[model samples]
Target: MYQYDGFDQEFVRQRSAQFRDQVKRRLSGALSEAEFKPLRLMNGVYLELHAYLLRVAIPYGTLSSQQLKRLAMIGRKWDRGYGHFTTRQNIQFNWPKLEDIPDMLDSLAEVEMHAIQTSGACIRNVTADQFSGVAKDEIEDPRPWAEIIRQWSSLHPEFTFLPRKFKVSITGSSEDRAAIKVHDIGLALKKNDHGDIGFEVMVGGGQGRTPMLAQTIRDFLPKSEILPYLEAIMRVYNQFGRRDNKYKARIKILVHETGIEKLRSLVEAEYEALRASFIDLPQAEVSRIQNFFTAPPYQNLEDQEALLNQQAQQNTGFGQWLQANRTGHKQPGYAVVTISLKPIGGIPGDISSDQMDYVADLSERYGFGEIRVTHEQNLVLPDIRQDQLFDLYQDLVSQGLATANAGLISDIISCPGMDYCALATARSIPIAQALSRRFEDITSQQNIGPLKIKISGCINACGHHHVGHIGILGLERKGEEHYQLSLGGHAGFEASIGKIVGPSFKEHQIVDAVETVVQTYLDLRTEDEIFLDTYRRLGDTPFKEALYAAA
Candidate 1:
C-alpha cells in the first residue's frame, strides 16, 4: 500500500473540511436542492430511495489492515453494520446520514482513503489487476503506476467537468485481469524484443448503453512517455468528445464516430506537445514512485506439491476451495487467494466489520500484510503461502468467506440496483440473488464452466453487464421490469462487445431464458469449448434460435 505523504495528508484534510461546510449549508437549507445536488455528488454522496449512499475509493483496491479496520469502524458507527464492495473495486455505505458524510470522510482521511472523484463527471479511480505485484504472469507492478495516475488525475481542474465520466485501467500482465479493454483508456505493460518495459495503449473502450472494446491506439509506448502520452489521449477525448447526449459523451463514442486512424493521429499530435511541456515525467520521478512497490519478504521454499496434493486428497472441501480460490503467484512459495464476498446467502459483496478484521489478520498471519479488492467485488490475499493455504482455508471457511465460485455462474457482478441507486430503472440485486439461488450447486456451476453473469438495473452498466459472457440488462417497459439478454461478450485479453438476442423477457421468465441459453451452449459446444469460444466460432445464430425458438 502507498503511504500518504505530508502533502497527501494535507490534501485530504482540506478536502474533507471543504465538504463539511458544504454539508452544513445543505442541511441548514441555505443551499437549494438544485444547488446541493452537484455538490453532494462531488463528495460521493447520493440520495437513494431508502437513504443516502457514500462511495469510497480504494485506490486500485489496495488496503492496509488499518484501512480495512477504519472501513469496519465507519460501517458500524455511522450507518449500517456492513459495506457493499462494488464492481469497480469500491465500497459503498448504504445508510449514512446526509449530515455525517463529512465526518465519515474525515475518518476515511485518517486512513488515507476518501470519496473524491468516485462519482460525477470525472476520471474515476484508476483500476489495475487485483493480483498486481504478486501474480506470476506480471512483467512489473502496475499499482505504483496506477497510484501515479490517481495522484495526477485527482481533482484535476481541467477534466473535473468533462462531458461524462472517464475511467482508466492498467494491467501489468498479458492476461488482462483488470478488464482494461472495457475502460475509457486501457494500458498493458509489456517488454519488447529489446527487453525494455513499455505500455500497449488502448483507447475508446467502455461499457454502458453502448459497449465497445477499445482499439489499440499505440502498440508500443516507451516507459518514459506514459504520462505525456496519457495526457495527450485524454486531451483529444475532452476536446472532441460529444456532450449533447450523455449516452454519446464517452470517449468510446468519439472513437466510434471518428475513425481509429484519425483519433490516433490526434492523440499523437497532442502527445508531441505534452512531451515538451509540464506533463513530461522524468525517469528519476518514475523510479522514485516505483520504488515504493517493493516485493514482500519471503523465505525461499521449494515445491510443496506432494504435501498439498496429500492434504487435498484427505479433505474434499479443501480440495474444492483450492481448485477455485488458489491461483499461481510469481514467488516460488506464495499463491494468490480470492476470498469470495459472495457467501452462500449473504449479499453479493457486503463485508462485516468482524470479517474485515478477520481478513486483515489472515493477510498478516498467512500472506503478506497486504490486501486487494477485485473488480468482481471480492477480497484477495495475494501472497498466501501454499503451506499455509489449508489452515487459511479453514479459517476463511469458518468466517463464511470461502465460497469456491470464482468465475463461475454464481459469482455474479451486480450493482446495488433500484434498492439503493437513484439512476436505476429496475431492481438488479434481487434478480441476481434469485438467479444465484437457482444455480447454487458447485458441480452445476463447474459443468457450466467459466461464465460471467453480470446484471445492471439500467443501461448505466454499473454492474458491467456489457462484458458478461451472459449479459442481462434490466429495463422498465410499460411499468414492468423486463430483462434484455446479450451473448458472447468478454472483457479479458480478447475483449469483444456482445450482440443482443431479440426481445426482452418478463421478470419471472429471465432465469429460464438464461438457462435456455446455457443449454444451447452446452449442446453446440465442442468437447473443450467454453461459451465464448463456441459463440466466437459459430456466431450468434444458434443462441438466438434457442432463445426465440418458441417466441
Candidate 2:
C-alpha cells in the first residue's frame, strides 16, 4: 500500500478542515441545500433518501490493518454499525449524520484515507485488479500506475468538473479481473514484441442507460506517456463532451457521438501537442512510487498442497470454502483468500464493524497486514498461507463470513437500490436477498459452475447488471416492482452486454424467472459448459422461450 507522505497528509488535513468549515456554514444557515450540494459532493458526501451517505475511497482497493481498523472505528462511531463495499472497491457508510461527517473525514485522514472524488463529476477512485501484485499471471503490478493516476488526477484543476463523472480501471493480468472494458478509461499492462512494458488503452466504455464496451483507442502506448495521454483524452472530452444534458455527459457518450477513429485522431493530435510541455514523471519518481508496492518478506516455505488436502478431507465446511474462496498466488505457500460478503439471505457487500475488526485482526495474524476489496463486492486477505487455510476458515466462520459462494449465483453483486438511493426505482437489496435464498444450496451453486448475477435498482447500472451472466434490472411498472432479465452479459476479457430475454416480470415472478433461465441452461448445456458458455452457444432463443413460454 502507498503510504502518505508529508504533502499527502497535509493535503488531506486541509481538505478536512475546509469541509468542516463548509458543514458549519451550512448548519448555521449561511448556505442553502442547493448552495452546498456540489461542495458536499466534492467531499464524498451524499444526501440520500434516508440520510447522508459517506463514500471513502480505497485506492486500488488496498488497505492496511491500521486503515481497516480506522474504517471500522469510523463506521461504529459516526454512522451505522456497518459499511457497504461498493462495485468500485470503495466503502459507503449509508447512515451518517451530516454533522459528524467532518469528524469522520478527520478520522480517515489519520489513516491516509479520504472520500475525495468518490462522488461528483470528477475522476473517481482509480480501481485496479484486486490481486495486482500477487497474481501469478500478471505482467506487472498495476497498483503503482493506479497510485500514479490517483496522484495526478486528485484535484486536477482541469478535470475537476468534467461533462460527467469519469472512472479509470487498470489490470496487469490477462484474465481482466478489473473489468477494464466498462470503465471510462481502461488500461491493460502488457509487454510488446520487444519486451517493453506499455498499456493497451481503451476508451468510451460505461454502463448506465447506455451500456457499451470500451473500444481500443491505442493498441500500444508507452507506459511513460500514460499521464499525458490521459490528460489529452480528458482535454478532448472536457472541450467537446455533452454538457447541456447530464444524461449524455459521460465520455462514453462523446465516443459514441464522435466516431472512435475520429476521437482517436483528436486525442492523438492533442497528445502530440501536449507532449512538448506536459513534462512526464521522471524515472526516479516512478521508482519511488513502485517502491511502496514491493513484495513483502516471504519465508522459504514449500507449497502446502498435501496439508491442505488432508485438512479438507477432515473438514467439509473448510473444504467447501477452500474450493471456492482461494485463488492461486505467485508465492509458493501463499494464497489469495476471498472473504465473501454475500452470505445467503444477507445483504451483499455489507460488512459490520465488528466483522471488519475481526478481518483486520485475521489479516494481521495469518497473512500480511494487508486487505483488499474486490470489484465483486468481497474482501480479500491477499497473502494467507495455504497451510493456515483451515484456521483462517474457522475464524471467518466464527464471524459468519465463511460463505463459499465466490462467483456463484448466491454471490450476487447489487446496489443499495431504493432502500437508500433516491434515484432508484425499485429495491435491489431485497431482490438480491431473495435470489440468494432461492439458490442457498452450496452444492447446487457449485454444480451450476461460475455464474455472475448482477442486479441494478435502476438503469444507472450501479450493480453492473449489464455485465452479469444473468443480469436483473429492477424497475417500476404500474406502481409495482418489476424486473427485466438479460442473458449472456460478461465482464471478462471478452466483454459483452447482455440482451433482454423477454417482457419484464413482476417482483413475485422475477426469482422464478431467473430459476427458469438457470434450469434451462442446466437442461441444455453440454459437458462442463457454464451458464455463459451455454447461453452464448445456444443464444437467447431457448432461454427466452423457457422464460415466457407460459405467458
Which tens-of-lDDT digit does each residue in 1-551 have in candidate 1?
68888999999999999999998998898999889988878778888888989999998989988898889899999976889999888899999998889889999999999999988888998889999988888898888889889998998887888888889999998799999999999999999999999899998888888888988999999877787787788788888999899889999999999989999999888887776666565667677778888887888987677888999999977877888888898888778899988765456888998898889888888976888999999999988889999999999989888899887888888888888888899888888888888888877878888888888899988888888888889999889999989888888988877778889998999999988888988998899888889889998888888888877
Worst 10 residues of 2 by lDDT: 542-551
What residue pairs clash in candidate 2, if any at all? none
Tens-digit per-residue lDDT, 1-551, candidate 2: 79999999999999999999999999999999999999999989999999999999999999999999999999899877889999999999999999999999999999999999999999999999999999989999999999999999999999998999999999999789999999999999999999999999999999999999999999999999999999999999999999999999999999999999999999999999999999789999999999999999988778998899899899878888889999999999989999999999999999999999999999999988999999999999999888888889998999999999998889999999999998999999999999999999998999998999999999999999999999999999888998989989999789999999889999889999999999999999999999999988989999888877777
The regions of model 2 sitting more than 4 angstroms off are none
lDDT of 2 at 359: 97
Best-matching candidate per lDDT: 2
State the TM-score for model 2: 0.99
The reply for model 1, stretches above 4 Å from the true place, is none
Which residue pairs of candidate 1 clash?
A: none
